[model samples]
Target: MTSRVNPQQPSGTAPVVPAHRVVVLLFEGLQLMDVTGPLDVYTAANEYGAHYVTSTVSPDGGPVTTTAGLRLVPDLSLDEVDFPVDTLVIPGRPDWWAAVADTALVAGITRLADRARTVASVCAGAFPLAATGLLDGRRAATHWRLADDLAARYPKVEVDSDAIFVRDGRFITSAGISAGIDLTLSLVESDLGPDIARKAAKFLVVFMARPGGQSQFSVRQSPRHPAHSVLRQVLDQVAADPAADHGLPALAARAGVSSRHLTRLFRTETGGTAAQYVERIRVEAAQALLEAGDDALDTVARRSGFGSEETLRRAFRRRLGVSPGIYRDRFRTTRPHGTRED
Candidate 1:
């Protein structure tokens, strides 16, 4: 009998690709969750049968202390790390400002990135990644509080303060703390397919896709005060009673100016229209109500001046990227999570 040619053993063919290599870069004073959160997501994917080879590395081939006070020994140091890593994840340090200023570490990162197929930053890790010049001219997201500073420092990088995470080219940057998981899940989806990612998300008890942009947090409490006293008065009036009418005509009349002039003033002073400001005020009111109480959706809508549930839903979708019910579910303070009174 003729010798059989093994289809699996095609001679002269290139070797098959191995399991993906994921290297998480650890540093002194790094946020513990920033390293563990994304790593857990990847490791959980492996638990579901996806093949991912994960390891940790640091500047020195030794143990490093995290912000949480736990000392972690890395698998290797930057010197021992293999070249052409499949995924290079840099977790955030508490003092990213100082991390960027560490010339030796920044040089090592640039060298590592030069060989890595994909590069990522968790939260303020973007600071060091940005320092490497890879994020230059790329759209990136950091913790919303520090986004402005990042933009100010690296004028070449476009900082998106509102995104939960951003991917530009081979660089993935995420907003503060929990957003790293979101970014990693997206990567898992891209690498292993959506089914695996969905299962992993379920296993982790996280949303397959979280409902909204980065939570507004402190930004909503302080909007810019208009230079014009009338605009300030209009803002105050709207805040005083979100249920009340504060349309352009009403505002224009109250300001003792023509509607067109009022519109121009609003654009100049607030950088948006009168209608936009009112909608934001209403959304803020709705957010406050949802967070504080267990009111009916319709009641909340009407009280927030949305007039109807559909309008409230639309407004929430437009501004928060989530439905009213979903927002309430995520933010409700009236009851402890996963507890329903019998």
Candidate 2:
């Protein structure tokens, strides 16, 4: 049971009992955007007639400074939180690894998570949450820059670097920065349905389901051409058309250099073997095709220069840790978080 709030009336003017109670756990050195972005989504949802009460809580019920130098005051201390939590949000700070080492903070989070129906982390917040062992054997997401570190730190938690957000059962984790909004919108859709979610998204001037996942924003997706002129044209050709013949001999011949010289340049400049670079480029190409269209796997393979569906699968697995189909499935879930963000 919930209260219907009229937009014309002030929220405090009424004794409103929201349908959902969202508790955001604040910490020192946290990112301000990680806290505000998702909360704004919930606020926009409430404006559109949804009943969500979002509150902030800290370890000691005091003000904490963000990395950006802004100060935030929580509604109460974690110790004073007695109500049932519908969703417990964890926002990340820059020194999140250190927070994981803070036993008092980890213990507080574990305690709240135990009471919360659903748990979520924004950006690097996954680090602290994972430390609680709640994400063990669960697929999670974090900031792209911190994804490898998160995986390295918690071997039991499956880190998804590609997704803006990942939902594994009741635990939801979002990627860095603004992905928290995408995560929160997806939650809104889950609770309030697509119609109201669309209204909220429209008000915020953001897509209900954004077009693609994190691959579009990844640094690895950038073309890593060296400053040298000799390798420029060959790299350009490979990037412009992935399906073109880009064998070592062909590349060397096209660049008018010896194969040995070309290999040396690739290793020296790109820090990877020519074959490895080609495979990664091909995988990147395949990722584009998979995200953009409903092409068959074999079709995508040929277009992306993989030659066959099996080869494409192998390449995707090697590069992205998932098959081409799953990659597409994950990327396409953004029809305003239709299923992709899920």
Candidate 3:
């Protein structure tokens, strides 16, 4: 959604309303949801008496087919646009890396972003923005699967794959498909008000607002392959029971190797030391417990294999950058008043 903040609207007064222009950039093979999700947010807001004029644009302003074999006809072509845009959104595609190499598309986006109040992207759309140098040295977010690729391609840009969305200056980026809705809702909240955003979210049946820094819903796993049968067995055992006797000596015994040799092999095969893997697995266990219920901190600590509350706190702070209590508050699921379904 496009917006221009009015200085005349004082903190407690009614906001000066204007019709904001929101333009979505489209191309062949774009992801359909990336285009529809954010559009739906602005449309819902407009239904609530918010003035959001939304439209779509393409290189030639023709019918663009998506990767899913669906077609989208644009409202305007780049050459036909005469008015200034308040917001410019670039949606992503499954084959987004191919789009990044399109110098013409990158150039067009660069020109539009220079004139727009805010430039945003969904998922791998960050690649094209990075190509134009707009995201250089700026924090950005994208789908977790492509986060490493984005960071590797654009060394200057700080990629935060864990985030659902990230706002750096006037440039905003969101994680995968449904996350675009979250980013648009945040923009609606920023431009209109929390009440309108909440109303829009309710109509859309989504959260009123979700934090940009929330982690993506995926479990972390070791990237490296196990080099031996014993290593695989040890890994499985640890995953099954984080509270098991997994110290260096015990793990070495379980693996039928010396402690020093186990350490070396674990690092070589798992790309992390045994102790590091154990700690990560323990943190994952702790995260599950924290999200499932409101257990005491000490109880959570022991159940997750941290042994003590202080140790759990330290581990949480080091790994997740939040205390156990804060993590629980953010992630714990709530049941309906009359039913247990979440």
Best by TM-score: 3
In order of appearance, the predictions have TM-scores of 0.71, 0.68, 0.72
lDDT of 1 at 202: 71
| Off by more than 4 A, model 2 | 1-18, 211-213, 216-235, 241-342
Clashes of each: 0, 5, 0
List, residue by residue over 1-342, the lDDT tens digit for candidate 3: 232333334556553467788989998888899999999998888767677788798888888999789999888887776788898999988887788978878888988888899999999888888999999989999999999999999999999978889999999999999999989998997888766777778778776555576567633453455768878888888889998889989999888899998888787887778888898889889888977787788898899899999999898888766677766643432322222211
Candidate 2 CA-lDDT value: 0.81
By lDDT, the better pick of 1 and 3 is 3
Question: Global lDDT of each model?
Answer: 0.79, 0.81, 0.82
Cα RMSDs of all predictions?
A: 9.2, 6.4, 6.0
Expressed as tens digits, the lDDT of each residue in 1-342 for candidate 1 is: 011222343567542334778888888889999988888788777666566777788888789899889999888889998656888889888688989989988998898888888898989999999998889899998998889989998999999887888888899889888988888887887887766666667768886544336443533355666788877777778878989878889878877889998888888887788898899889889888976787888899999999998899899889877787766654432333334221
Q: What local lDDT does model 3 show for residue 233?
A: 83
Ranking by lDDT: 3, 2, 1
Q: In candidate 1, how many Å is residue 334 off?
A: 22
Model 1, total clashes? 0
Please state the error at residue 254 of candidate 1 in Å. Answer: 7.3
